[model samples]
Target: MRFVRLAADYPVTVFGLTFEKLLIIGVIAVFLLGPERLPHYAAMLGKFVRSVRDFANGAKDRMREEMGPEFDDVDWQKLDPRQYDPRRIIRDALSDADPFAEPATPVVARAAVNENSAYLQRKRKREALGAGDAAPFDSEAT
Candidate 1:
């Protein structure tokens, strides 16, 4: 089965150019290049693209030759940059994880302090001092 990549998968897209944008670019190019020189530039662009494809194919062939036919058997997907994305990998792995699984212990335990008792004492003192139920005031804003 062919792996069809979804557009949403591309998190680092630039411009996110669509057909409308491409058409707008083409119109702008024609205006800047002018009708007289447009054909010439178009031909040149085609030639440049063709040369790039040829160069890429040549490089792949050279790599295969140097590495032997086993190079072609390499799992290209495993070497993909997305495979190294911690967030995406973790999300996929945990998508089907048991929701009822026991929680793991904290790596670094904090002191067993009774924070609620301390807070209650502070609240009582604030109330005895006629402080409002509102949060503590900050002079920074003023």
Candidate 2:
């Protein structure tokens, strides 16, 4: 037996950068910045990262506060933008139809009306008369 991994099972990489690649980038940055400016830039980068982290955490906390208990009930995976598909959305909406509710169009009346239509009447007559015979071709139609 073989195990198939889903898309969600794979670990996501930022710009496909590994630790070795990031170390190489850091070395290049250090050479470019030099020892003097490197410390200042590193401190600034740390501060920027901390601020961004705080901002994200604050937003999450704010959302939790606003939503109250419903925040935990939200299906985060379903809301992911990557999984979004208009066809899937429409299919789900259609599948969630109320079984007990009345249909938008009356099936019996629609069928009766369709049987009375001139086109249907002609088709039925044609089918009944034709049986296994080939359909009559009109050259004028072409």
Please report the candidate that would top TM-score against the real structure.
1
Off by over 4 Å in 1: 1-8, 11-23, 86-118, 126-142
Candidate 1, position 111, lDDT: 88
| lDDT of candidate 1 at residue 102, scale 0 to 100 | 49
Write model 2 residue lDDT over 1-142, tens digit each, in one string.
2243456765565689866788899899999999889989999999999999999999999999999999999998766676556664675577767745554553554334666889998788797775678777889999
Screening candidate 1 with a backbone cut-off below 3 angstroms (N, C-alpha, C), the clashing residue pairs are: none
Provide the TM-score for each candidate, comma-separated.
Answer: 0.56, 0.48
Candidate 1 lDDT over 53-125, as tens digits, reads 9999999999999999899799987677654756645765777866456444538867886757988888776
lDDT of each: 0.76, 0.78
